[model samples]
Target: MSKLKIGLIGANGRMGKAIIQVLAQSQKSSLSSATVKAGSVYIGFDSGIHSGIKETGVIFDSDLVAACKGSDVLIDFSSHTGFSENLSIAVAEKKPIVIGTTGLTEAEKMEIQTASTQIPIVFSPNMSVGVNLLFKLTEIAAKVLQEDFDVEVLDIHHRHKKDAPSGTAQHLKEVLLRAFDRKEENVIYGRHGMYPERDPKEIAIHTMRAGEVIGDHTVFFLSPEERIEISHKAQDRKTFAVGAVKAAEFLSDKSKGLYNMFDVLGI
Candidate 1:
């Protein structure tokens, strides 16, 4: 059998380069091509060498339709603008898409959903299986934890992140609402000024950015005398790469639909 030919978008970015490394390390994997945005300085560079690995002759091209011409699946860890354009091509070609991009607006999300009806698209706020399981666990924990305890989620990302309260933090908030059967109004973001006493019905989220941390998240159940905290920390980008590859493998023969890491990891 032939190896899966993966066409990677955002090949010049940090996460994209990491995916290339993971693919190179796997014998059963092959990169069909890689892409950066048009006019990027990395257009003519070898994909592997660009990722600090031995040369593999895969040049970073910006032409998505041509780059993905012979690919079995396309994996993207790119930005929203690039992804939106790529989605049109993927839908037209009826190819599977594994999107790891964050910070999409509601309209972009709707676009993804619309495309999923035409092509298989695996979508998730966080691609790491550990984080997805943590999301599911947050629900289970919220269900049984003491009502008096305050639920708080703390997420830490790298200093270069542009968005506050990370995507994972927001996803955790959704899990809390479902498990606790509470409304969005009950969730508090920042409470500095003389806000009154705590509300047991509300869940709070806090974000911290520092250093070169890949990602770290914790959910705290705090009571009078004790606290129970659940945490998941990503030490490297390869974890997401591996998880994404697993998701790609799953989509090989699957029908068109939208899926999250929960569906990929079966949590």
Candidate 2:
């Protein structure tokens, strides 16, 4: 069987390089093309060499559509702005995409949803298997604990990360809200000067960005006598890259629709 051809966006980025390294070793897929931003230093260079590996003869291109021309699927870890444009390009090319970009607005998310009707898309905030399982465990805990415990979410990331509260943190909020049957407005971002006592109807989320922390998330379920903490700490970027590669492999043979890590992992 032919290897699944993969075109990668953000090819010179940390996650992109990580994915390329994994794909290089995988017997199931091949790196067909790689794309970086226009005028990038790595443009026109061999994708593998740019990613700190031996040359693979796949030159880094500037045009996303051109890079994805013959791919079975495209994996994206680019910025929100870059993805917004590439989303249209992917749709135009009728290519499947696994998107790992975060911090998208509600409207931008809607755009992805709309496009999924026409193509296969596996969109995830954190694509680490452990993190996805953490999501499941958090949901199970929320269901059992119910209203008896006050829920708080804490997320930490590297200083260079662009978004606050992290997409994984926000996704945890969604999972809790679903398990509790609560609405969006019921979540509290954080506390500041002079506020009333904690609201039982709300869950609090706190975010921290500091020195080179890959990613860490903790969900605290606090009660009168005890506190139970469910946490997942990412030691490095390979976990996410591997999960995304798995997502790409899963989506390669699927029909048009929207999917997530749950669909990929069958949890």
Candidate 3:
């Protein structure tokens, strides 16, 4: 098979740079273009310099259409806004896309859904295989754990992460709800002083941000005797890089549709 030409959006950001490293090192794929902001210092620069590879012949650019044109897939590890703007261009080009961007608004999500009619896209907050497994495991645990146990998800990330509760926490909530017959009275956010009592069916989510921790997550089933914790800690960013590459491989040359990591990994 020919090489899977991947257009990487946000190539200068941490995850974007990590993906550059991944494709350069992996024998399976190559970067066709690395898209950065127009005014980025890295624009017109070789991706492999800071990406730790001498050169892969792919230059970073801010031209979304030129960057994605004729590519097999576009793997986005950029901001929601950048992804939002780039998405339409990808669809117009009929290129597949794998989105690892977080913090998308509801309207932006609807835009993605509309774009799916013309090109395939995989949108997920976190693409780590372990995190997807955590999503699945939460479903099974929530169903069998009985009414007494409370489902609480806790996530910790580097202090620089701006989104509270993290997208992973919200992903867990969505999956856990699938196993329940009824909706909760409320989704209890980080409870504080004068907080009301916890509802048995409510999914409580908590998050901690500090230090340089890569990412650590725990889903707790709290009951009288003890607590059952199912967690995944990402020691490095490569796990996500691998998953993003996997998503690219999954979507190449396919029909138009919206998908997630669960679909990419066949979970």
Candidate 4:
């Protein structure tokens, strides 16, 4: 069988470089094209060499449309600024896309929902398999603990990461909300001065940006009797890259649908 050709966006970012390395070592897929911002210095550079690997003859460019047209599937790790354009080009070119971008606004998320009716899309905030499992475990714990346990989430990432609370942390928040049948109003960001007492139904998310930590998240459920904590720590960016490649491969033959890492992992 022919290897699936993958087009990558934001080929100059950290995740992009990791994906390029993964593709170079993949037996089921190959990097067909890579895109950077228009007029950027990285344009015209070999994707492999830019990613610190041996040459693979795939050059970086800024033409998203051409990249979509030339590959069997697309993987976008670009910033939220170019997310709509990348998504639009994928829909226009009738190509499946695996979206790993975060920090998208609600409107951009709605755009993805609308576009999924026309083409297959694997949209996920965190693509690490371990993180997804953390999501599942948190849900289970929430269901079992109910309102008896006070819940709080801790998210830690590299200082260079732009978004607060990380997308993975937000997803963990969503999972808790769903499990408890609560609304967005029931969530809290962090605590400040003294209050009367903690709300049993309130879910708290705390974020910390420290030196060079890839990613770390822990969901804590505390009761008067005991405490339960479920966590996942990412040691390398390649974990997410592997899952992104798997998501692209999952969309290789699908026509139209909105899917997530749960779908890709069959969880």
Candidate 5:
């Protein structure tokens, strides 16, 4: 197979740089276009140099269409900001895309769903292979332990990270809900002053932001007799970066639809 050309959105951000470095080392892919947010310092510069790799002549631009026009797939790490416009451009250009953005509103998520009918989209909140495995495991555990144990989710990330509760935590909550046939009302976000005794139907979620920790998540299943904990710790951003590139490869030349990490790893 010929090398796949990949375009990157938010190519000046931390995740963007990591993806670029991973692609630089990968044998099956190469950067075709790199787009930064408007007025970025990296604009007009070689994306390779900004990503700490040798120059590859892919200049960082602000035009999303121009970027997508030059590639077979686009990997987006640029959170919700400017996402709608980028998605529109990708759809108009009929290019496959891998979206790793988090903290999207319900309406934005609906937009992705609508666009998926027109273009192939690999949409995932957490792209780490281990984390996706945790998702599957969490579902299995939830199914087996249904209604017998109280469940809770806890997540910690770098202070610089935005989005409370974290996307991975939310995904885990969804898994538990689906496995147990519960509803969104069952989720309780971080306990605070003067709350009543925990309800059996509630799945409590807690989030912490401190230091430079990459990411850590723990799911607790507590019973009167004992406790079971399942956790995944991300030591670095490279895990996510590498998985996203692999997702791009998985999405290449595929049919139009919305796919998740499960589709990529076949879990």
Candidate 6:
């Protein structure tokens, strides 16, 4: 059987390099092309060597259109700044895309939702399989606990991560809100002095960025009887890379739809 050809966008970032390494070792998919920002110094370099791996013959370039046209699927780990263009190219070429970009605004996400109607798209903040499971578990716990428990979320990542309350944390907040059938008004970022009291419907998300932590998230459910905590901590970026490749593979045969890791994992 022939391996799936993968065109990667944002081939110079941290996740980009990790995905390149994953494609090098993958049995079901291979890197066909990689794209970097325009005028990037690494533009003409071999994608594999630039990613710290042996030569794979795929060179980094700045042509999103060509890359999208030449591959069976596209995996985008690019910054949110270029996400719309990436999605547009994929849609125009009619190629399925797996999006791993984070820190997207609501407007940007609506663009993805609109684009999904034209091509298959798997968009997720964190593509780690374990993290998706954490999402499901959090939903279940929130449903079972209901209003009896006060819920809070903790997000921790590397100090270099610019976005506070990592996208995963935001997704967790959404999950909790969905399970509780609450609105955004019930969610709080963090506690401050002089608060009257905590609302049972309130969900808090706290963020900490320090050191070189990959990612860590914990959902706390506290009540008078007992406490239940659901957590998923990423030890390496490879977990997300592997999941992104898996998402690409899942979209390879599809035509049009919007999906997430849950759809890929069938959880």
Top candidate, metric TM-score:
4
What does candidate 2 score on TM?
A: 0.97
TM of each candidate vs. truth: 0.96, 0.97, 0.95, 0.99, 0.97, 0.98
Q: What is the lDDT of candidate 3?
A: 0.84
CA lDDT, candidate 2, residue 204: 91
Query: After aligning candidate 2 to the native by TM-score, how far in Å is the CA of 164 from where it should be?
Result: 0.7
- Estimate the overall C-alpha local distance difference test score of candidate 1: 0.87
Q: What ordering of candidates by lDDT runs from best to worst?
A: 4, 6, 2, 5, 1, 3
TM-score of 5: 0.97
Q: Where in model 1 is the C-alpha error above 4 Å?
A: none
**Candidate 3 lDDT, tens digit per residue, 37-148?**
8788888788888687798778888888887764678998788767677887887788899988888887998999999988898988898998899888888888898587
Question: Highest lDDT, which number?
Answer: 4
| Alpha carbon lDDT at 148, candidate 2 | 96
Error of 3 at 264 (Å): 1.5
- Evaluate residue 243 in candidate 2 and report its C-alpha lDDT on the 0 to 100 scale: 96
| lDDT (Cα) of model 4 | 0.94
Report the number of backbone clashes for model 1.
Answer: 0
Q: Write the per-residue lDDT of candidate 2 for residues 1-267, one digit (tens) a residue.
A: 999999998888999988988888999999998888999988889988877889888898888878778799999998888778999999989999999999899999999999999999999999999999999999999999999999999999999988988999999999999999999889878778998888897899998899999999999999999999999999979899999999999998877999999999999
Worst 10 residues of 1 by lDDT: 140-149
Measured over all alpha carbons after superposition, the RMSD of each candidate to the real structure, in angstroms, is: 1.3, 1.1, 1.5, 0.7, 1.1, 0.9
* Clashes (N, CA, C under 3 Å) per candidate: 0, 0, 0, 0, 0, 0
Instruction: Give lDDT tens digits, candidate 5, residues 41-106.
Output: 888999889878899888999988888778999999996888999999999999999999899988
